[model samples]
Target: MALSLVHFPSEVWNHIFQYLSAADKFSVRASCRYFRKLIDHWSLWKNWTIVLSFKNGPYNSEFWDSLRRRKVSSVVMRNTKTKDWSRLSLALPTLTTVIMDQNSNGNLNFIQDFSHLNRLAIRSSAVLLDLHTQTQLQHLTHLSMCNVLFPNKSNWSFLNLLPFLSSLTSVVCHNTNSFGQRDRMVDTLVSILPKLKHLSLSAKYISPQRDGSIFKPVTSLSSLELIDCLDHSSPEDVGQMISGLKCLRVFFKHSHQGRPEALSASVIYLKTWLSESAQLSNLTVVKGPPVRMYATSIPATITNLTLCVSGLSPRDMAAVAQQVPDLLHLHIDAWPSHLGAHTARIPELFPKLRSLKLRQDHVPEKDFLRLQQLQDLECLEILDRGHWSDLYKKLQTLTRNRLRVVTSSPQRDAFHCPCVSQVY
Candidate 1:
């Protein structure tokens, strides 16, 4: 018998409704008064992430405003327009994550509302009139701040930004090379953000000052990263800093402002510290140079390692194959370091490895023989730069080995971006 939609229980109907997008969910609610009541009873629409457009198109802030009339609490705007942020309806004080960033341009503005906000993300140069950067944000846990500029006000210092975010646990902040004076900005950050477990901060020339008063270390820090550390500190000082973290996750990468050689030295000392530091089991190093310089440097107890090198070249693969024995998982963004130089020579080295993930740049070619050698391959994704032409061949290869399922997505403009998604 064909069942009518009316006979389904609210719980069952909700399960079906959860799959719909916020816009589609609203459309369903608008079909009738009963839907409005039912949707209003659901919290799915209470938090929203909408991209604001300053250019004033069909899907701009006004569009979001219309949706706001339905009662959305949180909003995450990506690649937003200046006007969209300048023209918010202020009905969204309930928002927890707010991202107004992109190639758009507009004068930054301050928010005087948000009495119920817990977390916030801003991607403009606007100075936050931070009641504390976070206070009264009782439920706030993660904050992503990017492209934020200093207003030259005596009142708005970095340390001043943190007392308000008393509840923040994770943060990802990026500063443009053209940003405020490097040392001053970094000094402001290190002195602030008192309590943190996961933090990703990039800076230029952050040499630990002689006067401990100038740079007070945050003792509660657990996972610390100095990504793109541009001429920040001497190799010795950096090793000292890493040693201070009782438990940590550190990532140091190459940058335009500093010498690659200096970054390499820091990586070596970091590798040393990881080996000696007690109670530190998680260690990851990438992007500086050959792993041979530091692979054996990793603590033998380390259980997780990710390498972001260009390709699975011999030295790179060999370093991993010989060094890490207690490793639990491996993720590699595989690309051709040299078309026929290194990787082609070493196909049979990684025999003891457990889990492997081969992420392609744009092509859909599998290093088939490499897959056959791994003892275990848990997750595989065929990421297509545009579209897959040889889906069947790849699928047949996967089915032949009885490997676990894989996930994929074709090349598209608005795909999942870890940087933009999390960098508030």
Candidate 2:
């Protein structure tokens, strides 16, 4: 007698269904009812995200019922113009994540309908948030807004409502045009959102209040990122804002329009803070040119350091090595004329370095080969692939196949291994 798929128990069929892609699973379901039942199991749909379009009309009852039956927990709304959110809320009460993008005619009042929503992202949309309804989203833990507009309110007034959602742990606001009174807005958020742990903001400029007072510290915040948002502020002001945060473990500051003098001043303040911070383990500074001046201020507690600047020289590298002897990860994105001359000394400089990423340094193959001397090195990434051939195999042979080499664009080869492990 021949054994057939039906002869296997449903448990085995369900296990097999997990390995199949959604399209393949649907194809298998079409073949027999047994497979169809197994394919419809909620476990298979647990990780699926449904994309819905409201440009035409609301989905029919059968479509909504199917989503509910499958236990769909996430949905992405595109081209949304619907006002019939009550029906959606009643149909898919299990939704925990909602993303609204490219929507122009929708109001955020619908967010109150999803009682279980934990994450919400709004992008490229102009919408109104009903302040009364926002307080009802008690379960929302993460909120992200990008290029969003709330025409009825004053600049960044939506931020004032964040205190009502007590469960929020993370918030990101980027690329919005209404950034007036940033100092007051940020001050209010940090003071009110006691549970907030992560915050990222992008703006044209970030400075202290008109009264010359710096940002207040928040004990709960562990990670902070400011993007393209520094200018004219005194180093003392920047230092005060960062040093006040007692729990900050990770900090990233990137700016494209910042003045050279202001950026250098900011780095000087960062050096003072870095020397005193016992909890700050990861740091990134971009578009600054005076890293060498403050390299000695880096404390040994920092295990991860990233510098994206134009003034990183061989002497600066040596200074960083001397300061942070236990540094485990280092990334330098610079094109200094003499960096390649000092490449051979890296192993001697950072003996315990586990990962190294270099961009546009143009080190020679022989100098690159000297990196094999790092006994603990696990990964080496090079952005400029001009000077080496068969370098990956050579390094693997030297390290007994323990090291992973990634060349060219990091994005294209990110999966080769862990791509620059996060500080957290």
Candidate 3:
């Protein structure tokens, strides 16, 4: 007897197709008319990403033509060529989110045609758009650009262009030019965009000095993120800059260089600022060091905390942990040598922690067992790629005990599973 997928009900077919690869799904579509109709369902086409090197591969018009009937809301074009970006987007009228990589020194002409764009991200190269082209993006609420640069190296010219994007509520400027002209980028952004609620900037783009006149209190901002790129600023300088965010709720910063003393000092100053000026609801710091373990205190308003530190000490960890009694989600990344002493202290440090993520550096078995001690923990993830048959077996036992241990391999966004190795 031959096995027949057609014998299955439509719901069963849909469930089965969800587990198949994209190529396998296409194969199923080609097998029968019923399957073809089922595969073209709008649910399957709501989000799609197409990658092509305009410099190498031919334009896939058929791919774009097929999306016309589907409800594609988001699309990503990777390694995109400099030619007509307008024509590529003209085909997708339903697209609300567009992410593209434009070649070096490419004109941002394609973005002008996206009248319905709500979110736009330029992931590669700097973009220089004319005033007329900037006006067309009045509907854009979120914009992310990489390595932003304008002609003549004049910061005022760039600032002048942003007011035209009045509808922008969120802006992310990453890897911006670090010349002295942009010393007041934050103040310029807040002054120009009254509706901006969220902003993210690379720390290197901002100067350490405080511009009291330009950087006054702004109540409109709700969230802020800063990515460190060899920041030379002091903690007091950093604190003063963020102190004006009176309505800010979420503040996340990642100092890639991991200057523990400077970061701790900033946090200490920020804590004082938060108490006096604005209150932050969520705080996440990456590559942080324990400089003020004895002096600094974590704010009580922080319920979600993530601290990625190197060379963490037991006393320092205990001191930092005591600051947040209401924390529900905690993610810690530290050297394995410094982690052992804190194993038994995990439950005591975060009594209310519901989600725990520990990066696999050199974790001991006792630490994992101590993590299992937290009765309130609902999710636990161990991230790394290495031979850990013993650890895997221990986690395997957790699944049987009704405590699912999620483990992921080297991939950044891989899903968690008790048996990740077998599945992968």
Task: Please tell me which predicted candidate would have the highest lDDT against the true structure.
Answer: 2
Candidate 3 has which clashing residue pairs, if any?
none
lDDT of 1 by residue, 1-424 (tens): 2347666687776677776766677798788765665665435554445554545543546545555665665555555554445455354555545555553333333233555554556565445343443343445676655666655543455555565665677666766332344354333444455555666565343444554542333445566555554334433344444444543444444521235556456655556656655445555444555555566676655555566544445665676666556666655543434323332222355444455454433322454434544546454443323244355346447557545534443222121224432111
lDDT per residue (tens digit) for residues 82-199 in model 3: 5546556666765677776645555556766666778877665655556565666778898877655655633235555676888888887766552354466666687789898887
Better of 1 and 3 by lDDT: 3
Tens-place lDDT per residue, model 2, 1-424, is 2368478888888888887777787798788766666777888876677777766777798677667767988777777655555666888876888888788746777877787888887878887656564565667888877778877653335655666878888777776644564545445556777788777666333445566554555456676665553434323343344543333322234432335656555665556656656566777766544567677777677788887666566777888888887889877766543366578888998899899987535667788788899999998887566455477688789899899876654322111111122321
Badly placed stretches (over 4 Å) of model 1 are 1-48, 54-73, 77-91, 102-112, 128-140, 176-194, 209-219, 231-235, 243-269, 276-286, 334-355, 360-376, 383-424
lDDT of 1 at 379: 48
Q: What's the lDDT for candidate 1?
A: 0.50
Please give the lDDT score for candidate 3: 0.60
Every candidate's lDDT = 0.50, 0.66, 0.60
lDDT at 357, model 2: 85
Give me candidate 2's TM-score against the actual structure. Answer: 0.71
lDDT of 2 at 347: 91
Count the clashes in each prediction: 10, 0, 0
Give the range of the ten consecutive residues with the poorest summed lDDT in model 3.
413-422
Q: What is the TM-score of each candidate against the true structure?
A: 0.66, 0.71, 0.78
